[model samples]
Target chain A: MRIALDAMGGDFAPDAIVKGAIMAAREIDEATSLLLIGKEDVVNSLLKEYGYTGNKIAVVNATQVIEMGEHPTKALTHKTDSSIAIGFGLLKMQQADAFCSAGNTGAMLVGAMFSVKAIEGILRPSIANFVPKLKGGYGVILDVGANAECKPEVLEQFGELGSIYAKYVLGIDNPKVGLMNLGEEEGKGTVVVQAAYQRLKANGNINFIGNIEGRDLFNDKADVIVCDGYTGNIILKMAESLYDVLHEKGISDPFFDKFNYEAEGGSPILGVNGNVVIGHGVSSPTAVKNMVLQAQKMVSSKIWERFKKNYNE
Target chain B: MRIALDAMGGDFAPDAIVKGAIMAAREIDEATSLLLIGKEDVVNSLLKEYGYTGNKIAVVNATQVIEMGEHPTKALTHKTDSSIAIGFGLLKMQQADAFCSAGNTGAMLVGAMFSVKAIEGILRPSIANFVPKLKGGYGVILDVGANAECKPEVLEQFGELGSIYAKYVLGIDNPKVGLMNLGEEEGKGTVVVQAAYQRLKANGNINFIGNIEGRDLFNDKADVIVCDGYTGNIILKMAESLYDVLHEKGISDPFFDKFNYEAEGGSPILGVNGNVVIGHGVSSPTAVKNMVLQAQKMVSSKIWERFKKNYNE
Candidate 1:
């Protein structure tokens, strides 16, 4: 299996990304291949600085880097030689089994959609993250920020996709799917959420657990929680901010520490044709290394293929 | 000022509610009068347990109590002698200067709407809460669970109400108002937020500070944050859950403590005809006491009158 790394895409550019790639190449299965995409000299210099001579690690040259502030589509279209574009190109050409980046999220999403494309029967892609609840169980929150405005049908699709992710990737059997609503009652949310709840409840393909309020998210009420991108994004960010503030205050707790992983490591772009992981912009080497491993797990688990099959079925 | 306390409301009703009323009667200097509404015997027993003998504290007979699980309208309408109904009646008859309760939120909102009613020019009343940011400044997140679906004009009114509350209640002069969106750009949110942004930006009544994303909510970007009740409720609950989980895990931080005020004490029903504060269902005596003080402040400041005048102007 081969993974393409956008070495120049994140805030901690070449150095951290290169080091993480080397670390993953060294520790991961010997059969795994690592292809780092960035400016040739910068990548080589970092590799040399780390004294990385592993045969699994290789460098591919790309001249430009997508700045975090640049417009995603504009940057992708204008910077043809950018690391993200070239890495995505490699994934499209089957040179890489998976694509991973801790870069501009919008740019990564745009590039993934344009390059790797979406799975058949999938209307839109979503970003899914695991929120560690206090009960030692994790809930999957989807469409973190992919499409801000989603139709009721799209939310139902997210429920299905999130359930499958929890079942296969997270190793939870018969994952319970829930529609995030303002209240727990059958008719408690907006028009979109109400419609989505009805559809989700009728969906026999998964364990539909009915509507769940935001407070229920911290418990073991549901394994997979799905909502429109806007609400999901707000929830995910609020959780992230909470963890951050707690971590910064030196409040050491095992539950919160579980969420201390680099932002980029755990977020996977779902509904794409292939495995694509997006990390936090300020990811550390440890986070990048973990992301590579996460991608490998997704590839081995055949998550996308399962999604495609279920979607077709 | 005469205040009606729902002795049968909240998780710690009668005990905490009676103790808080006694405290308010003894400490508050506004010629306070308390009409404790609940099962007369139970309320009297709890008051005797606390050894309260203040002339200001009185008991009004109410036979039924609204449970958290019951529907608000059905419970209020059917249980004519319920504490919530009696409290509303006190307000409607002008026998009490204000009504305070830590009961079912839906019922409280329903009773407030039916009894106190909305002031003219007010489309709908909203609930606001304080969300602490990383920089130690608090943001007023409004419409936490009032109106589920909101139009652009309604959001504009929320912006106005939130700004006034921030300026007078929280004492943030020239408070910056933000329209909650998925992104910070003017064209970043859903149709509702986008149109509201345009209207807010054009309106001279508020200090409209463009759109703010979920992540920026913790960064002290704006003093008053406005969103539809659906999104606001989700965010509020999510934040509350975070605080709960962190507090449970022994994550000590000033933010959690700062926001630990009882909902019964601090949640004033904005845009209502008179001073009505809805506390959280799990409010303790301290929170109830604080809410009474909050009501006193609103009364002294003539918050309702000021809102009416400014809304018209």
Candidate 2:
């Protein structure tokens, strides 16, 4: 399996991305190849600086880089030869098994959706993250800013998607899925959540754990938590803020350390036709390395195959 | 000033409630009195157990208790003579300057709406809380589950209310108010939030700092953050979960320790006709004492008077 890396994305750009690619190419098996996509001279210069020499690692020269502040659609349409577009195009053409980028999140999302397209039965692609709770395990929150306005059925789909991820990627069997609501009672949320709760509860394919409030997210009350992109995005961002604040205040723990790995691993764009991971814009070399490894694991686990089966069923 | 306490509310009921009332009465000057509302015999018995000799804490007989599981409206209607109802009734009759309770949140909210009534010029009363962020000051989040559906105007009002609290109550001069959105850009949120952002930005009365996303809530981006109750509640709960999870994982910090105060200090019912506070049903004695102190401060600061003046302006 080969993975395409957008070397011109993120704050550290070519240097961190090139180093991460070289590290992964060396550590990963021979069958796992790496394609570094970026401006030819810049990427080549970084590769030479690192003194990297390996058959597994290759470079694809592109001429443009999209700034973080540029409009995603406008830039993608205008800068057709940019590193992000070229990398995603490569994945679309089956030249690479997966594409990973620590770039403009909006642009990455747009490019992935436009190029790779959504899964057959998916309404909208969602993003998932493992936020460590007060309890021993991490709570998985989905749709963390993919589709802001969601229907009831959309949330139910997130439940299915989140459940599979928790079980396969996070290594939890029979992961408990909870619908995010204002209260724990059966009818304690907005009209959208209430409808989704009923549908999720009736779906026997998932380990539906019923409704859970925000406070219950970190209390080991459930493993997989599903919500609309709006609420999910808010929760994820707020948690990120809390972690930063607590860490700065000398709160020492594994959870806070996780915050230090700001770009440790990027969010997987679930429901897409291909393996596409969107890393943080500020991601460093270590984060790029982790994201690359995460992509490799996801491919090995055949997460897409499981997603297809579950979605169809 | 006299404040009525619901002695039969909360997880530790009579004991904690009665003790909290006594503590408040002792801490505050003789000019402040507490009317403990509950079963006369039970309250008197608990008061004796604590060996309270203060006459400032008086007991008003109440025969009914609202359970957490019961419906707020139904419980209030059925148990007209309950502590929660009677406590609100005291405020309605001008017998008490304010009311405090660590009881069924929904029940207290319903009772306060009926008895205390919303202040003129205020659309609806919102529940607000202080989230300790990475910055030295806290982020004031409003509408944490009060009104599920909100208009653009209501969101703007929340921003104004949050700004006032952060400035006057928390002592932050010229508090920066941020309209909660999906992104920090001008047109990055829901239709309602977008419209509200424009109004807040144009309004000369408020220190509108523009839009802020969820990730910025803890990064000192804004002192006062405002959103509808549904979104606000989700953010507040998520933050609470993060703090709890981090703390449980032995993440030691003096900042988080301050949250140890119970929900008994209750939420100050913003946009109300008078000073009214509602605590969580699981509040501890310390929370109740804090709520009592909060009530006194609200009264002395003439928050209502200032609100009316600002509304006219």
Clashing pairs in 2: A134-B245, A245-B134, B266-B278, B266-B279
Q: For residues A142-170, write the lDDT of model 1, one tens digit per residue.
A: 88888887888898899889988998888
The best candidate in terms of DockQ: 1
What are the DockQ scores of the candidates, in order? 0.70, 0.66
Model 2 chain A is weakest, by summed lDDT over 10 consecutive residues, at A255-264
Residue-wise C-alpha lDDT for candidate 2, range B26-66, written one tens digit per residue: 88766888889999999999999999997898899999999
Model 1 residue A298 lDDT score: 88
The residue ranges of model 2 lying beyond 4 angstroms of the native Cα positions read A133-137, A259-264, A309-313, B133-137, B246-250, B261-264, B309-313
In candidate 1, the residue pairs with backbone N, CA or C atoms under 3 Å apart (3 or more residues apart, or in different chains) clash, namely A264-A279, A264-A280, B263-B279, B263-B280, B264-B279, B264-B280, B265-B291
DockQ, computed on Cα atoms, for candidate 2: 0.66
CAPRI class of candidate 2: medium
Error of 1 at A34 (Å): 0.9
